[model samples]
Target: MRIGVPKEIKIHESRVGLTPATVRELIANGHQVMVQENAGLPIDLGNDKYREAGAQIVDTPEEIFAQADLIVKVKEPQKSEIPLLREGQVIFTYLHLAPDPIQAKGLLNSGCIAIAYETVTDKSGGLPLLAPMSEVAGRMSIQAGAHALELNQGGRGILLGGVSGVPPAQVVVIGGGVVGTNAARIAMGMEAHVTLLEKSIPRLQQLDSLYGSRLNTIFSTTDALEEYVTTADLIIGSVLIPGGAAPKLVNREMVSRMKRGSVLVDVAIDQGGCFETSKPTTLADPIFTVDEVVHYCVSNMPGAVARTSTFALNNATLPFVLALANKGYRRALTDDQYFRDGLNVYRGHLTHAAVARDLGITHTDALNALI
Candidate 1:
């Protein structure tokens, strides 16, 4: 198998699909890896390093896309890269297709087998691949929100951890999954008043047990969200629905009533955000004001911390990458139902049920599609 790693072209996205260590492992497994020139240079994994790891350094993305059987990427293929995809070629990356119909249509027309990292599951019903980045994004959400709360950043001029004379800022986290848990942990660490809301009673109880008196765990309800959101100084939206679009728990009316200078950080922005007012922002211009409330909705928050994020992501994704390389997509996917869940598109057919339902497209069972 010939695997390709392309430099991320998204604005301020410095992460690469494969690291030198990962390439070396793939080579040890008898797979040929082709990496775009300087794909890892931005993150300090230079071309010489890749060469030392037994990867062929291609000069352009076109060559990498044209020749490689399996294309591993950090982000979704951009519009320009979509045209280069060939029938039966594999694209393994984070394909947030539910909210982006253009990308979905492009993948379908290209006739490529697309596996989304975000949808892949583990035996524990966790998104193993998306977990690393989700953890990074969740932690960064608090940091970004704290910075955004500064008066100069157009925030409410409140300090996350206030001085003895002042009360600390109130931080509210929606969702108690990987993202939410991390967000609340960091917020609490910062000495801010923290509250977590979740729809799952079991999960809420679990969080309550874990945090004890340090964090307030609340059962999520329409009234609960509205009340907390309205009074929150820093609101972090970490809601997710697997491959489907994130539910809009915070509506425009709720946002309109938020206190001026307050900050809303939507860690779920990659899945179209749980906050109704969130539109994807870039690292170049990370935040914008809506209804006088600041919104930090950068779709790729982890990208800002590329070196740490890249290594973390590699650790989570390497096993799946090797599985696909060793047994080929068909055998590898068919052998593992969790891996099969990653199959969003198989040779032009939409195979992931949640994605299909979210996009209003027909879905083919992954097993049937592969056969």
Candidate 2:
């Protein structure tokens, strides 16, 4: 099998799909790996590193996309790259298709096997491939929110952790999943008043047990969201619905009612955001003001820490990459139901039910598509 790694082209996105180590492993397994010239250079993984790892350094994305059987990437294929896709070619990456109908249509028309890293599940029902980045994004949400809270950043001029005689900022984290948990933890560590709202009672109970009295765990409801959101200084929206679009928990009215200079960090922006006013921003220009409330909705938050993100992502995705390269997509997916969940599009057919429903596209079972 010939595998290709392309340099990520998203604005401010510097993470690479494969590292030198992963390329070397693929080569050792009798698979040919083609890496775009300087694909990992932004993160300091130079072409020499890949060459030493036995990877062929291609000068352009066209060469890799045209020749390789499997194309590995960090972000979704951009419009320019979409035309390079060929029928039956495999593309493994993060495809947030629910919110981006353009990309979904492009994949469907390309007739490629699109495997989304974010949709892949583990036996524990966790998104293994998405976890590493989610962890990074979750932790960074606080850092970004805190920075956005500075007066110069157009925030409320409130410190996350205040000095003696000054009260700390109130931090509300929506959702109790990986992103929210990490955000809440960091907020509490920063000595802020932290409250986490979650819809799952079991998960809320679990969080309560884990944090004891250090973190406030609340059952999520309309009233709860409105009350907390209105008074919070920093609200981190981390709600996720797997491959579906994130629910808009914070409406425009809510933003209008929020205290002036408050900040909103939507970690779920990649899935269309849980905030009504949220729009994907780039790391270069990461914030926008809505109703006087600052919003940090950088869709690729982990990209801001590309080196760590690339290595962490490679660690989680390498095993699955090898599986697809060695056994082929059909056997690799059919052998593992969890892996099959990653197949968002198979030869032009939408294979993930949640993505299909969200995008209003026809759904096909991954196994059936394999046939």
Candidate 3:
């Protein structure tokens, strides 16, 4: 099988689909890895590194998509790349389709096999491919929020960890999944007053046991979120629903109530955002003010730290990539139920129920479709 690693085309997306090490692994498993020229530049992995690892470097994306049977990417394919997709080709990437009607429809028409990273599940209902980036995004949410709190950054100018006689800033994190937990951990480490709202009691208990006194864990309710968010200096939106669109936990009304100079970072922006006022922002101009509340909704939060993000993402995705290349997507999914769940679109049909429901389209069960 020929595996293609195209340079990510999404704006501000520096993470490459395959690292040099991943290329070497695939080559060792009797698969050819084709990497586009300068694909790993932003991640600090040069083309020479890939060549040394036995990956053939191609000059054009057209060459890669033309020859490679499996096309892997870090983000969803942009409009330009959509034309390069061919029928029966396997595209493995983080396709956040719920909010992207256009991309979803495009894939449906392409007759390509689309396996979404965010939809792949583990035995415990964990998203394998999305975890590393989620971790990076969660940790960075605090870092960015902390930086955004300065008066110059359109924030309250209050220090997150105050000096003696000065109280720390209050940070409210909605959702208690990977992003929320990591955000709370970072906030707690900074000595900020951190409150986490999660709908799951089991997850909350897990968080409570993990950070008994370090953080405040609360059962998330719309009323409670509205009541407390307005008083916060930093509000982190970290809600997720697998392949489904994110629920808007913070509305414009909620933002209007927030104090001037307060910052809201929506980590769930990739899934259509958890904040009503949230719109995808780029790193160049990563913020906007609505209702006097600073909003930071960079869709690819992990991309900000390219080297770290790329390596971490490779760690999680490499194994699956290897499986797809070695066993072929069908055999790989047939062998592992976890990988099977990754199948969003297969053989020209939308196999993921959530995706079908979102677009009001039809779908068959992935297992049945694969068979």
Error of 3 at 95 (Å): 0.5
Cα lDDT, all candidates: 0.95, 0.95, 0.91
- Residue pairs in candidate 2 whose N, alpha carbon or C atoms collide under 3 angstroms: none
Against the hidden true structure, what lDDT does model 2 obtain? 0.95
lDDT head-to-head 1 vs 3, winner? 1
Per-residue lDDT value at 101 in model 1: 91
lDDT of each residue in 1-371, candidate 1, tens digit only: 99999889999999999999999999999999999999888889999999999999999999999999999999999989999999999999999999999999999999999999999998999999999999999899999999999999999899899989999999999999999999999999999999999989999889988989999999999999999999999999999999999999999999999999999999999889999999999999999999999999999999999999999999999999999999999999999999999999987899999999999999999999877
Candidate 3 regions exceeding 4 Å error are: none
Q: What is candidate 3's lDDT per residue for 120-186, written digit by digit as tens?
A: 9999989988898999999999999999999999999999989899999999999998889889999
lDDT of 2 by residue, 45-125 (tens): 999999999999999999999999999999999999999999999999999999999999999999999999999999999
Q: Candidates ranked by TM-score, best first?
A: 1, 2, 3
- Assess the local accuracy of residue 3 in candidate 3 as a C-alpha lDDT between 0 and 100: 92
RMSD values, in order shown: 0.6, 0.7, 1.0
Error of 1 at 325 (Å): 0.8
